[model samples]
Target: MQSTYQTAALNDDYYYSDILYSPYQTLPPVIQDTLLDRQRIIVIANNPSITQAKLEALLQPTDMLVLFNDFIHAEFFAYHPSAKDLPKLLFFRQNGDSLLHFGLPPRSNNLTAILEMTKHATLGMLFGNTDYQFPLPSDDPRPNDDPITANRVLEIPKPLDKLLRSQEHCGVLSEQHSVVADYPVFADIHSSAPTSGFLLYRLLLAACLEVQQQKNADTPISIVMLGFNNENKTANFWEGHNWAFERQELATPPHGVEIIRQY
Candidate 1:
């Protein structure tokens, strides 16, 4: 399926409509009314498209929202200063989708393994350092004149490998009745960065799962990051690591949520 982001690009103008009731509307009563429902909704926006003020207005009572820093959803999530507190209402980028799809360094990582295993896969890597906040406008390809683009910098925590390699054991979950089973399960994705925006995305998914659980535990929710699509491999082209993407351990769902491998 085409990601919501890819669908947006196909349109003549870059505008995409929100499916939920928007706070941007002039109707305060309407906005107030929807907020009362207190539903778990996932809001995804391209970076720079939203202003701080606008974000503040939307976040007050939202269950969760995911924001992308650029055209592709990689940079902001991979290397943003605000990664730590990891607001349920925010996600951003410091670079591009490539950073997330192709992880940095030695070719022995999970991403490398995937490329080698999946014949003729397409690859991309995205980067994020929990310890480093991406520079707003100081030195980057991002446009310089946007007033909304304040020249700010932040510091995040380190990457996952540092944290995981230091640990002795990691937990594993296997279940067929859970939500993760409904979709074609790829391996679970995780990040080592403490402020890692992807964690927030995971939490947001948790919240959505909670909502789904309240009604029916059997229903499955399908969520794919906006910018990553690896498919239609050619049998003739099989260079290992050429199409690799980085991903860490799978996360265990909180209490009532079960993460099943749907393969």
Candidate 2:
């Protein structure tokens, strides 16, 4: 069966939306296992100031990296120059975009970029819906930009509608659902609405904390968040997303996660 994320790709329609609700369940099994295996799980955000050189100095071959959204775009490659030369680390592309099969005979640019990405991620480039802040400029390769491109970026993530129907590697996250399950308090705290980074942050932290509880502090897992901002950068902020709350959350790092502020 497909996992929640694999079914998480593209989307449309609003009646079926989960309404910012989140419930966690062990950080997706594969992600859980990844926590147990890697010494570190670095989540890279597209804040631009975060460069590949900076990441390379922090990452090891045994470490795991997570990239989402337009990290596959050329801008990312330019920022992280010689990214293809980075250590052979295992990684996960927990897609910030929902997974909709854009059937165009598979662009090598897409596939090659995929392949070059720590080998398209040993974590199998998991897919899931990360909440989108409307009116934001899209960086995805498409015919146009903004509303239309972002609209087609997903088909409509009926995640709650199709739970656990995809493979473990290609899992789906009910976005807010995935967050609430493990970190209910975090998810429910003061309208903490944001994008996938918040959800993915909680998801990975949940898994790491779980393993940490097993007393693996002899070699504790470290989570470093890079290229993240604590304030809203968009001209139009999405309603209901408490940027202040999210900023607070990031400012006071949780689950041993470190924030390297570049902006």
Candidate 3:
């Protein structure tokens, strides 16, 4: 039997709205095109459940790889070494906590991780924001930098900020957690902001659909995920990530999204 969190992603009720949400329609053309053009997109998240064996069975040479903020973390790469040569895109958080991966000196573990993370990837986009400038740790080793990220920086998709900071909403659903469930969530600090992975999924799905409509032909594209365990994140007043709600959404995700649970 499939665990609720591991159930297949199949729901016709996918909702998209708000000027800041997916279908926001302002993503860089390159990011949009790469995603829509792929036959399959493999999104490897930070969840520890992901393993090399599981990925070997699902990953294909033609499949695009998508990883989040910690893509430059040595621990992350050590944990999933197959992901070291990412040839597609990377989305990262610019918040203080995430800066350590990029802020340290070149001699430390930062440079190697940066090179391995970007050498093969076409683009590296920032997902969150901070008061400080975007850190490009690889700039020290300037000659080795990839142009897409070396020269340009992407702002947080407005929808992302809106969705996260919106007091009126709860992740994919607008209802507050208190209203959505018989539980308590501190609205100010503990509101349910959808995880970056979830937001990325919505963005890619909408982009693919848009591309198909423009081509006037169906292009089969899908987002397959590995190691996305919301079970570890809980939504009590103290736990912030809206673990309960996100798990519920993933349990019944809309079409074109697949959750590869362990067999």
Candidate 4:
């Protein structure tokens, strides 16, 4: 039982005005409805232009736990009295540099914790970059000195793992040249450019679609692509390109994930 929802048209001035710039106190009803209905939700933002004020404003309404790429962004919510008071507003930092620099409270970096968070996340946004290394502690000696390794590893969680595994292993946009992972769920995009944000957004969408299809779930999934500007003006790898959501006939891939692209 697959159903389609339409995102508001993008304004010419802003990259994602309908979503990123929408009023915080009263978000679009569609967004509210989807949040209420969906079993799984993932929001991806990589736009460097996004400010602390904007992020905090958007987060004010939800009880979602956020996984930030660095302490720069995580600190706002992590330290704010209001944010701290919300027991549901948990945060995790993926960047070891920030973790080591700030010396914040440690949270479990185990795969089990990640899986549990993904399964239960009411509203989640993952920032790209910050170099998400996995299965290794943030304080690991190897990454301490030479943070940007000649070779890097990108980790994919279980929910996303299931979705990517269903595809034909096209390399991710980021690690295209590197040795790809042998497993269907893991592979490198092999590019030096910063494309993780875009890739993360795509993967999150794919994962949500896969879950809905496989589970025969009827709840609607709403996606807001934050920080993508016209002409790929942002630092994301896909420069000179712009993406928008256009209404089209719903088409499901072999993996049973339906994707809606701009016409």
Give me the candidate number with maximum lDDT. Answer: 3
lDDT of 4 by residue, 1-263 (tens): 12122121111121223532222212213233333434433232434566766555644333322233332344444455434423221123233234321111122223333334333322222222222223334555445444544233235555645522332211112222111111122124222232333333343344344334445555324444334343434443332211222111122222323332221
lDDT of model 2 at position 207: 50
lDDT of 3 by residue, 81-148 (tens): 45444445555433323332222222122334544444444443433433223344544444243223
Taking all chains together, each candidate's TM-score versus the true structure is: 0.25, 0.58, 0.58, 0.36
lDDT of 3 at 213: 56
Q: Candidate 4 — which pairs collide?
A: 172-189, 174-191, 175-188, 175-189, 175-190, 176-189, 176-190, 176-191, 177-190
Q: Residue 212 error for model 2, in Å?
A: 2.2
Query: Which residue runs does candidate 3 get wrong by more than 4 Å?
Result: 1-26, 72-86, 96-111, 130-132, 135-186, 190-192, 233-238
The residue ranges of model 4 lying beyond 4 angstroms of the native Cα positions read 1-48, 60-68, 81-194, 232-263
After superposition of all CA atoms, the RMSD between model 4 and the true structure is 14.4
Task: Give the 10-residue window scoring lowest on summed lDDT in candidate 1.
Answer: 168-177
